[model samples]
Target: MADGQDLMERIGRLRPAVRAAGQPLHRPLLLLWAIAQAVHGRPRQQPWSVVKHELAPLLTQFDGAQRGERDVVYPFWALQRDGLWEVADSAELPLTSGGRRPTFAILEQVNPLAGLPEADYNRLIDDSTVAADALSTLLVRFFGANSGSVVEALRLREFVRGPIGASLLPLVGEQYADRKKIAEAYGGNGVMGITPLADGILAVYSDDKGPYPDHHIPETGWIAYTGDGLSGDQTLTVGNKSMQEYQKQEKALRYWHKPYNGSWTFETWAVVIQCRRRWGRGEDKKQRREYVWVLAPVPSPLRETWPSDVVEALAQDDKSVHDDSVDVIPAEVVAGQESRKLSAQERYQQLSDAARRTDGNRTNRSKPTLVERYMRSAAAREAVIIRSEGRCENPACGGHPLERTDSGQPLLEVDHVNGLARTGQDTPEFMIALCPNCHALKTRGAGRGELQKSLVPVARKLHRAMQRGERRKARPDGT
Candidate 1:
């Protein structure tokens, strides 16, 4: 029994060499060394890319060699070409004895590392294997760290360890910055958190922090509030009402409420910030504006770390965990599904059914009917109009408030500032963009005279006030 156990242990020790012998020889020197090693009864030719992929995390510690570089192929190929063992055709290069694959019975004779003391040999194998496994896992997880929130990705980085953990921090940080860049790309009138500072500078907070009804302005272009003690205040206000009136507006907007209250959540705030910056009027240029809203306390609990299982699972499959934490629900409920039991067959069937349903939904039985196409085209037109801020081309009515008419197919209709039918010109300058309400009122000759009289004076007054307001504020650097 003792001899048999010893023999089993010896065979187990030869596994790494056996596995290494089957890899491809890529680099010239390494390939030559591996081939020589194989000829001289040493394991040779493990897949070079596979080994490097496994070692990437640890190899990052070495100078000048990044994880997943082609340079790693040279060393691996050299090992095979050194003639440690004869390479035979197989998934792995098998040990050759008189042109035939050898059995496990000859394990000791074919292994060069096998001559080392058992303890040392085992330790080396264990360390290398651990490093390789860690790197491979990290590379997988690195690609999966695309959370919408920086905090989520940071939490994920903390749960990961060794090479994977190191790789994730920078990758996740880049992702976070990319999200900020995207938000900034939206430019003007983006959703911003405005904290009133006693100083001349406005403390513009990014919408990435949490949900609020206000627009998020970029910190880079914003006037830095130089007022003493202003930096300490991080809170901001939202909406057009006074503080008391805003408070009664319900937690639906403050905390994300589902269904009816889609715009009232943190995610919505992030999206709004992105949208306003990208598509808001005067967003591309610098301007001064005053906004008001009551600052409310954040209701959700702060997460200290990302769930370990989530981080681990996401590293393997990113899309699976994309919306994991976006929902406003208790973490305990989210965790329930992880512990649930389902047989392999049942899980397969469930996934398969989901795929079939998704495919069925995408199938088009007929060309989109004329009405359907019109509705789709109308929706696309509305999106374009919104993106353009519905600015009227007609100088006379450029700033007039516009509205949508059809609830389901709201189309933007412009009325002639100088009546088109009356004026008889095809020029865009004669047309004024009007909201559905204003367009209907103008077309039907209801309140058309009143609206025309009211808008001109209002527009003039607002323009003068904006100009005066812009001049009154002290510019940064006191210039």
Candidate 2:
């Protein structure tokens, strides 16, 4: 048997050699999920049902939709080869790609048999330092696919430097208290008798290899968001493309994506899973491989179809709501006349307090400033909407936002012209109004990036014209 030092080193060296396109996040995600459970007094060996419930959404969140939900089962069973984890199964392991097959009869509360060896498992639970070291190793190894080195990205925490203790673990604290809420939401008996995702929310298409509805990906299927999570007679009520039409389109479902200079498009949310990219046949070895589309509601669909109250509660935490469009109320940093230097302890405490107070407009020093930001976003939205005149600003594809919203207005969303998360200010001059389709097209791929760059000229022209019109309105003082 590998010693603890040997095992830890192996865990740190794990990589996504499994697939070409995607870095497999299964083992790392499972480790994080299991660690969180163990830290919270739940056993390290979680039930299959509980594991599925908690880990599937996280897998979708961390891993791109390229892999299926069954992928979650792999690390649970296969980690024995690596020495960090072991699965206690009754039967011989199955040989399918994703993982061991699960029986549908699952009791959510029942704990299944699985974990590290007894000594290792006990050490993990008894000594928080060991757990933190393990978590750091997993995070740094798996998330190496991210923009920068995980060490650099996570350096603010001591564990990222080297594990100080469980206290220094980034994912362990209340910053992730919202993980439970999200997990429970995913775990609940999801909407039945129809597909679960909203109409426009695109996902990687499945190989269509499996039985009827049992596509290997969990919560995987496109349930057109009719209303109340029921299929509107399985009609194309949400977006321009209906399921029937999509089925008939000779283009493989992989190619059935939004944007791409196509006549019609579908929108999807992805970490890097930006608007779906279909697999292609190049020459030999059968061109490209396809992803199994999972049938769970990503954040966008959850916002639209699930109960508003539920979404609000989930989104209440700043870190919880994963949607880019969801507004988070950032605390206004009130600059004191003479700032006193904080002690190291004070600095940590201050940061801790700030992390917890994510709710809107706390009545503290600058109680009223959040409204100013609210006004800016609101005003920018209205101006962009009016400027677009309810038509898509992208002259090439002037599609409406699917159907009109209930407010009797064209369904248009305000998007930052220069990119919101990057450098763009959320003001009228920097924002553009787009129908959902155009928005998707504008956001994905190198070709689309060029398109966005070209539209900058168009957006500047609109801004100049608007400025001119405003001067006309204020002609008395136009000089």
Best by TM-score: 2
The parts of candidate 1 lying over 4 Å away from their true place are: 1-396, 399-479
Model 2 Cα lDDT, one tens digit per residue, 1-479: 33344445455445445343445677766666665555556666755666666666666666764455455665766566656666665355334434444333322223357766656666666776666666644553354224123333333243333332212212211211222342242221122212212111122321122111222211222321111112112222322132222222111111112122322122232111111111222223222312111122233211233334333322332221122112211111112211764332333223323322332232322212222232225434655555555666665664554347653466777777778546424455566777787888888745788778777776767666654543112212221
TM-score of each: 0.20, 0.29
- Candidate 2, residue 376: CA error in Å? 50
lDDT of 2 at 164: 22
> Cα lDDT of all candidates, in order?
0.28, 0.41
Candidate 1 per-residue C-alpha lDDT over 1-479 given as tens digits, one digit per residue, 9 for 90 to 100: 12222322232222112122221212222222222222334433344333444334323332235534444533432323322222223234344445444333332233222122233224323444322222222222122132113213223333234433223111211222322342342221233343211111112343323332233112111111111111222222232221222122121122122123123222311001000011111232221122222122221111113333322322332111111112111122224555765432333233323323323322232211211221122222222232224443222342333333333222456444455335432222233445555556656756677766554443334234332333222223221
Model 2 spans > 4 angstroms off: 1-4, 66-69, 90-112, 144-479
Using lDDT as the measure, the top candidate is 2
